[model samples]
Target: MKGKDKCKALKEIRAKIAEENDIEYVVSECKHKGDCKGTCPKCEAELIYLEKELEKRRSLGKRVCVTGLAVGMAATVAGCTPASVIDPIVEFFGGGIGTEDLAGAAQPPEPVMGEVEPPIETLDGEVEYVPDSENSSEEDCSGEDCSEENGSEENGSEDPNGGSEDGKGDNDIPDLAGEALPPEEF
Candidate 1:
């Protein structure tokens, strides 16, 4: 594309990016109670400042990219081949020069292969097991009574009503207050 068209496209893309960034920032700030309709005045003011800064950065990036493209194109058209354009393409893509191209030159000596030595052992001996001094196993409790040494039984077998000491069942079902309701005829 022509330089002017490229610049226009770049500027449009930059403007879109800036708009998206500002929208995301606004959404995040509003979520944190920054927008005027949401909560504090100070946060709203800060949001406005951040939006302006984003706009300024976007404008600058577009201007710089366009200017660089224009300068590059002009230089190329004037027969000034830039090292930036040529060097990378040549180094990465160009095939190596053939041996036929260097036909009468003295060739470098072939690389010599050294003998492979066996790998040395690094460890002196087998691993030894070290028992931990503070290894304490947890005790298994019987169903009858598993209370700790200082206090009451863990189960509620001592309660006469077959309920807990607090009068609550394990399933937490409340006791019926009076006689059960009569069965429905259906």
Candidate 2:
């Protein structure tokens, strides 16, 4: 072969080798860049799969952030509403609602001085009254007399045989005091 023709043939063979190795070089470069714009069919498939995964992750992140914001705004609005706002509406309905009606009614009743209204009693029959003059007045008795009277009333009502008024054994008193006493010797 002629020298020029031989050189041309060698150059053509090198060019073919370089063309074959180009795919490998492109892949290496793409890997170094942390992403791939794959030129070959296999690498392009991998890159498409990765892009789909990244898109799914981004959508999930957006959904979570939006949901969190919605929940936070709802909580903030709920907390901001005045506790007193419901009171007037409840009171205007004749004061027979929940705690709101009671709280509203409580303020007005407190300020009106004198002539305090008596508590409504729930007894079935007409109330009986023992007059102050008829009842024993605490002012007439000394402190000692009052104490003795109270003590006598309690002790006199108690049964002597360690039993109650209903003739049942007294469950409240322990047997320890009786156990501690020595037996009587003749």
Candidate 3:
């Protein structure tokens, strides 16, 4: 298409994208009129923005399509119905195929009488929670060990005098000698 035609198409695409994405774009009137080359800075910037947004949406659409295709193929391979594969994708995309759309759809099979369900098992066969007498685990801290110890590292306590062994905790300020101190700035 010609430059003018392409620009027009892009504007239309941008308008559609804006509408779908709940965006608002106001078009300004061309001041150049007959002398307009259509490649003005404003038009070029808009063109770039629209192209990028379109590309982003196109990539997302492609990803969704690919995902849906893979899921459909996997469902088919797993002997699942098309509706089983398609319904979830439709729901996910905020769309739905109504009962009317699924005319002559296969009904799910009813459970047979006297059907004994198999017990669920883990990789190690049956999962049981048996406690070992040797390695007894405690859920909570209790007894003398549970109580906070004096001068413990966790409590940040260094000495019984509330300071380091040589005296002065982190919050203590040191006395500055007159000559050692820097002169006050005016």
Quick one: best lDDT, which candidate?
Answer: 3
How high is each candidate's TM-score?
Answer: 0.15, 0.14, 0.23
Model 2 C-alpha lDDT per residue in residues 62-94, reported as the tens digit of each score: 111111212321122224447666687666775
Q: What's the CA error at residue 134 for candidate 1, in Å?
A: 50
Instruction: Give the alpha carbon lDDT tens digit for every residue of 84-135 in model 1.
Output: 7567757556523312213463222221235342232221222222213212
Cα miss at 156, model 1 (Å)? 76
Worst 10 residues of 2 by lDDT: 61-70
lDDT of predicted model 2: 0.30
Per-residue alpha-carbon lDDT of candidate 3 for residues 98-167, written as tens digits (9 for 90 to 100): 2221455422222234654333221212222222421232222223342332123443322223434563
Model 2 stretches with alpha carbons more than 4 Å out: 1-38, 62-186
Return the TM-score for candidate 2, rounded to 2 decimals. 0.14
Question: What RMSD, rounded to one decimal, does every model reach?
Answer: 35.1, 48.3, 34.4
Instruction: In model 3, state the lDDT of residue 117.
Output: 30
**Model 1, 143: alpha-carbon shift in Å?**
73
